[model samples]
Target chain A: MIEVFFQYDFLRYSLFTGLLIGLLAPLIGVFIVVRRLSLMADALSHITLTGIAFSLLLGRHINFFAGMNPVYMGMIFAVSGSVMIEKLRHTYRFYKELAIPIILSAGIGIGVVFISLADGFTTDLFSYLFGSVVAISRTDFIVVLLLTSVVAILLFLFYKELFFLSFDEEQAVISGIPRRSLHLMFIVIVAVVIGLSMQIVGILLVSALMTLPVAAAMRLAGSFKQMFLYAVIIGEVSVLSGLFTAFHMDLAPGGMIVVINVVILLFVLAFTSKK
Target chain B: MQTNNPSHILEMDNVHFSYAHQPVLEDINMKVSPGSFLGLVGPNGSGKSTLMKLLLGLLTADRGDVKLFGEPVKSFKQWSKVGFVSQKANSFNSGFPATVFEVVSMGMYGKVGLFRFLKKHHKQKVREAIAQVGMEEYMYQNIGKLSGGQQQRVFIARALVSEPDLLILDEPTVGVDAQSVTNFYEMLKELNVHKGITLILVTHDIGAMSDYVTDVACLNKCIHFHGNKETFEANREEMMTAMYGHDVSVIEHNHAHDHHDHSHDHDDLAGTRS
Candidate 1:
């Protein structure tokens, strides 16, 4: 297992990307879960899928797009979707949650149109939908690394403000914590994370990677900080073991990772309920 | 427009606010002096919260000047000098994974500024704030595990942690028990008198808080009465009828018996108006 990294660059890239996603996903997930915005991740990921499909369709016709990574387009779409969600939330102040489903439906609707226009269901699309352990390119690995670093640094700088906002937004606004900018930064980062995680965990399972570990950790941890730590640990373990098992069993890495996450959540629920 | 007086902690002049064209507050003029505990008493839909929101810069007044600490609220940047605790029991998410210590530490976030970590002294201040509210023993305990009154105390401690010149509490004792409510008032009085933190308490039960506040303001779509506690007490009966638009008596109950159903009375009054 140790020498396998020396043999194949794609395997090595997959492992590193999986580990980084493991850390980044749950770190953002903690705040999302605490703020009860878990569905926001799903909406953003669906939008990312729309972006990827559009990019693929363009690549089929244009030489320039053929050379470009679809992840960049996916990120652009996800960020735009996030901005729209924020706008719709303000438009329908009384029904803020309405924004999520509207965006989710738009994403899937446009994504299907793009898929059908591009002649539908290629091996490339299947790999993007369910994730392949051997499909992570060096560029994807580098992009994930850069995104993970940026996210980590931003979180460290704005940890307290983010925590305060997540805990009570009204008080945070009253305290003059620059609510609008902070919220925009948070949602944009979440969008980018979802956009990138699509490479390691498929679009369908991306939200599970972002949410399941946090769900399990929420029941066991006593404080917000503890929950954050426990979630990251759970995420890393699931990602690593799932990738290893998938590599050996010739299974989709995303399916294995999400299954491991569910098993962990069930175990934690059972353990906590017994006490 | 009147020039902002630096001595006043808050000033709202001819402040008019509305929600979707329905007027909530109209021609509200009030000034909160430094080092004065002012009790803002009003009925359920009397715009007390909306007024507070205007002062806090959460909502822009449709027509007037609102200033905080000698600066217009729109341009006011020094938030560390002001603390606020809203109706915590009703609005708070019980399942939020935070300890009393973690929650209190949030108060220092604004003071500590952006891009900076909580240092050793910041931790000491957090612990001191918890101790001040007599919640030191439960500092590490999850906030959800505490009773409603205990949670309220923690929120007050959160406000206190900033050492603000002014602390505004909106209906802080709504769901608290009578005995704990008494202690809460005592703690607030100590903060006002001993610590010299200016206080603005918004409540339906002015009878409970009248003993603690130095001044009283009766608000119902406007400033019905804003004066010292002595003057307000002297005119209590006449003002209550005028402000509430009904003949009502305020029962200053003894805390020992704990028989006063303040919330019940509030609901009855609100039910009548609707």
Candidate 2:
């Protein structure tokens, strides 16, 4: 692993970025898991793909024609899509589950449209669908860093509110936690995290990164704080090891990271599960 | 009835609520004075729980007003000041990582507000609250690991942690062991007497309510009766007759009346120890 890190600047960036995501991903993953919104993470991640493909299609157009970073546009689109899912879910009370499929299909629909419209920009959609850790650019790293900060800061600032809400939503409501606002903000934060993570873990397995560690941790932890600690430890180790092996074997790091999480999940399930 | 009796903590005026236009509560009216233990009792589907929701603003009243501390319940900003324990005390995030202490700490969220974390005093409050419910032994235990009785106590502890002016508990003793139910009411009585916190307990067991509550309100989609404990005992036959919809449990009521035989004795019921 040290050798891999010392070998190439890209590898170093891969490990650095991977380590940071390992910490932040699972930290947020704990909240996502507790709130039972792990599936929403998957839906939002895929939605981000449409935004990413559009960014790819219009990178040159953005720089020369539009005078904007495609990343910024992509972020806006991804965040907006996340916000839309929240609105749709909330606005349609009787059809709460409908939001996921609607967002999922809309994303795929937009991706298909953008792919057709892009003409010749990055035809290898499989890479984005799955994951390629090496695909993370310097700009992508910056975005991930900013995203990690946003997630960490917001999570810290709203720690009590989110914890109370996630544990017992009705109690939180009775306590006047501004359920509507925090709920909207939660979806947006999830979108931002999913957007950045899609580059490495890919849309396909990003939710796994968000869910598996927390599930495993629940078996061992006695309280919310302990569960978070356990999840962070599990998540960080899995991603760092996966990133290293993926680099050495010349494979996609994101897929490897998720596979690593699944394998550990299985290990924990076998040992800890009562049934 | 007591020295700690302050102004009314809750006042409901012609409160009417329904689900999908099917009436669950009809023209309900009640008031819970501070430092009093009021039991909202009725059979199943009698809207005891619904009345609690209306008081907490958890459910909207379609045709009346629920005021908290003389203000509209909807406009109550200091919600944590009125603690709540829904009937489904165990129906929370069972898999979430949180101890009895943490769950109780969350009860302070309203008073602590956003951006402000729990300070040392908050920790002390949590510690005191958990101990108040006789759950200090399980302070660090995961809430999911506790039995039904223990879980209910933890919820009570969570409610108490807020140091509320009023505590509203809906069927909180359900699913708990018999001993726990007795213990829980005793704790509530202590809080109402010693700490001077108003407690509104919603339960189907009017008999159990008689054990501790200072006042009683019977409901069957509406208030069958609402007044002081002496009035409840004085009208025991009516409460029994009204609740059973004829007369089946009259023996138990007679037994209690005969056993206490102190309806007019004032101090006997008021100072009865659990």
B12 Cα displacement, candidate 1 (Å): 2.3
Alpha carbon lDDT at A7, candidate 2: 70
User: lDDT tens string, model 1, A5-102?
Assistant: 55899999988998898999999999989878899999999999899999999999998998888878999999999999999999999999999999
RMSD of candidates 1 onward, in order:
5.5, 3.4
* Error at B252, model 1, angstroms: 5.6
TM-score of chain B of each: 0.89, 0.88
Tens-digit lDDT track of model 2 for A21-84: 7788788888888887887887787777777677766764666634433445545666888788
Identify the leading candidate in terms of TM-score.
1
Kindly list the per-residue Cα lDDT of model 1 for residues B115-134, writing each as its tens digit: 88999999999999999999
- Best-fitting candidate, scored by lDDT: 1
Model 1 segments beyond 4 Å from truth? Answer: A1-6, B1-5, B250-274
The parts of candidate 2 lying over 4 Å away from their true place are A59-74, A119-124, B1-6, B248-266, B271-274
Tens digits of per-residue lDDT, candidate 2, B1-274, equal: 2313335788888989999989998888888876788888788888777777778787889998888887887776778778898987777656666888998898888888889999999999999988888889999988887898888888888888888889888888767776777787778878888888888888777666676778888889888899988778788787768776875465476446534653444465465422
- DockQ (C-alpha based) per candidate is 0.75, 0.78
Candidate 2 TM-score, true structure as reference: 0.91
